[model samples]
Target: MASMLEFRTPGWNPYAVKYSPYYDSRIAVATAANYGIVGNGRVFCLGLGPQGIQVEKTFDTNDAQYDLAWSEINENQLLVACGDGSIKLYDMNVNDFPIMNFHEHKREAFSVAWSPVTKDTFASSSWDGTVKIWSPARKDSIQTLPVGNCTYSTAYCPSNPSLISAVSTDSHLRLFDLRTPASAQYHLTAKIPVHVPSPAPLPQGPSPPAVPGEILTHDWNKYNHTVIATGGVDRVIRTFDIRNPSGGPASVMMGHEYAVRRLAWSPHASDILVSASYDMTVRLWTDGSTMPAQQASPVKAGIQLGIMNRHTEFATGVDWCLFGVGGWVATVGWDERVLLWDANAMLRGQA
Candidate 1:
């Protein structure tokens, strides 16, 4: 039987959920009132116990919180990206207020990511069309890489602190190498078109021309350092190898009936991933790169494994727990509900 737990935020809608890198029982959620249109935001530090999920701490913000990231070095500290272009660092041990505020972006800060390798620096992407690199000890950003469009997600390469990637409304995935000289175009080394024409034409008629769409979320594969997955307004998920991005997507997974809101590559498996969508469901998928011949298909390079449809509103955020047996997952949505479940149990034939 599958085990599941839930917690409701009452009036606030959660935009993102991140599991604590240090504690299995702890997680943080970024939320906004009135579905992030125009209201105050709240960040919740929640604890899981025998009694269930409980709020351990809460920080209210003057603007909507779109995304957050847990500090890799300090378990008690986390960062929140706000609608007002401010990024705030909160210390769980503190009472009622953020410990540090880093305001630089001229537009809404859409995403925040802590460097898994450096453990000291973090990055934030914004509607300002740039991704800024910063340190918790600094008052201003260390570097800003311009995306020229609304950059929705940004993450540092887990294996290389010098490498960072970001996706934007321009339907492009850009890779920046901080090791490159500043004169070399802001350290931007590669720009891969996220939407590419399908290799094969449909049987009945010609395949529709590929159209660019806004990319909302992306995540680097933990085990596969050169691989990254992207999802967006097109309702399709695509994976590409940073080394050979011109060769086109290594795999494509299509199933979501609405735009894909967020995606997370599993920490424990190279081929497994989970996605949350506006369709109000969280779906599991395998990239088919590691599947056996009979299990993989040419038309569908990646296949959906299962679906969890308990959310009553747009399923915006989903994340995998870094602890335990590795299948425990946490998801949050516009329904103001957070659901924790064992994903391994939902797999088609897994025992």
Candidate 2:
């Protein structure tokens, strides 16, 4: 038995982790105290002391601030999503309030993300059931992607700047292509209920148990944008080749004992996969399509490391990050702590 995680550095002892072009570590995170700085995802938890959750010194997303996004082009600029249907732009260097407040959504924005390929392009989805593309240069969104139900979360396609996908509270997954003349209107590419049939135990143990057919949420792979990996309420991680909408899953990865909340690929290692679930464990899987490892044992497949991943709360989001030098995985949760899982060390036992 070997450990999958090891400490590269203990920079910040904070609650959330985010990277922006403006900061030194390119990391800006939220804590119970002041916003902390990092040179490269490396943080130093600098705070006076702990205070009550209601204390003035305790850092919380007050009415003034809600969800936030780091600008891709302008490292110093931060976009904060407010409860008042407004997105505020903040400049860290001056410590001034928002420079621009874009109030477009009728309801509170649930999540905000920047396009990796498109400069000045960002997307936002709201509890109002719509996803809109925005550019600070213009007050109005060039395209408003319509969603069938209230979108829970969204991620822009990695390979294509215009392709985006989102999940709705109705438990349906929608994919959008921002190429049509009427790009504002989104088409329902695929929709399925997030449920799976109970499996009958096989002689071998129990064939890979039956699971839900529809995806819960999806993330565009950092290495290959055309490839999308989704985790669901069914407890399965399904990867799709969005390049060919007709193409089926490259493979279905099963490991988690409960509904999965997050899935991400290693930034440096394209073949490695990490997932988090409500079961309170994060499993690491290696792509085994063409190796002896692929057939070592069918009953035990895909997963290589079933780490007892500890978290303050259930894990919700996971991202690959490079802090100072090596690769690390950042996780967010209901508990509000942004944990750094040393991904490089997960494969230390590899022969």
Candidate 3:
């Protein structure tokens, strides 16, 4: 049911938004958590202490990070899926260069995630509507992921290596159980009832059917494996219990004025989460079930959450360090600045 395909080339750096692994505060014991701003081709790392930014290293890469993941393989290895349909694996261990790279997509790779269950295993989804499970040892998609739309983002369920959650541009979130056998063991079959609902009548004359929206981005709680969050261009962010993505969202966090761009859950705490948006704002969400009643559903909740006004431009990337002393959150933007925030500050301010 699986095969291997191999090739060798330099990794891609399309967006250059790779986040550093859970980094230790002690510089001597750290590999230096960094993010590369692709537009300017500048690589950024922490400046030490609480405020201010610094440049740890710089490299000339001509691409952007359409999708990226921090590898646990080593402190220095980072993988980035670029807009050019190329995947670049960088090894700071190799003089700040990509030690392994290849083209894995026919279109811009929109989302990627590193497998927490396997050392070298990872997966990627793209505008091509095809999701792939990859390992350095394989020749092609290990278990060619089956989906009906373009995947905007994907996250691996760290607790269960076999499960992956992806959001498509079609406004739907999907979960793939890779452990389920590709053949008959986990096959999907459904039968429609005899009373089929009439399709919506076409407008006026004989026009083509309108295309539907797709799911966008998603993440899983590291503390609780059952909960996953998804965002879409429809201007909504949804939290779904993988057991039932459709039954209803467990809790909806809303605040972006436009399409939600990215979502990240703190590895250190389950109740804490941060989101970025094209609306030029970053908002934090909590487990407290106090969202407004009218905005309780996915239809309204995506636009009701509170907004955090720290960044001054479109936020392209957001991440937090679980192992750091202060457990700081960082956001990079089109403004060419990477701002770091102390999550505790906002928590205490509200108190």
Candidate achieving the largest TM-score: 1
Per residue, candidate 3 scores C-alpha lDDT tens digits across 55-135 of 444433455556567677777566667656666666655665666666767876766788887667888888777677777
Could you say which candidate leads in lDDT?
Answer: 1
Error of 2 at 344 (Å): 1.5
Q: Given candidate 1, what's the lDDT at residue 234?
A: 90
Encode model 1's per-residue lDDT on 1-351: one tens digit a residue.
258899999889999999999999999999999999999999999999989999999999999999999999899999999999999999999988888899999999999999998688999999999999999998799989988899999999989999999999999999999999988489999999988875554222333337899999999999999999999999989888999978777778888999999999999998999999999999999998796653322333688999999899999999999999989999999999999998999894431
| Candidate 3, superposed: residue stretches over 4 Å from native | 1-19, 25-52, 137-141, 184-214, 289-306, 325-327
TM-scores, one per candidate = 0.95, 0.72, 0.75
TM-score of 2: 0.72
lDDT of 1 at 304: 90
How well is each residue in 249-287 modelled by candidate 2, as lDDT tens digits? 555677677878667676665557778777766677765
Task: Predict model 1's lDDT versus the native.
Answer: 0.91
Estimate the overall C-alpha local distance difference test score of candidate 2: 0.56
* Candidate 2: stretches off by over 4 Å: 1-16, 21-24, 30-67, 82-85, 183-216, 287-301, 304-308, 322-326, 349-351
Assess candidate 3 and give its TM-score to the true structure. 0.75
lDDT of each: 0.91, 0.56, 0.56
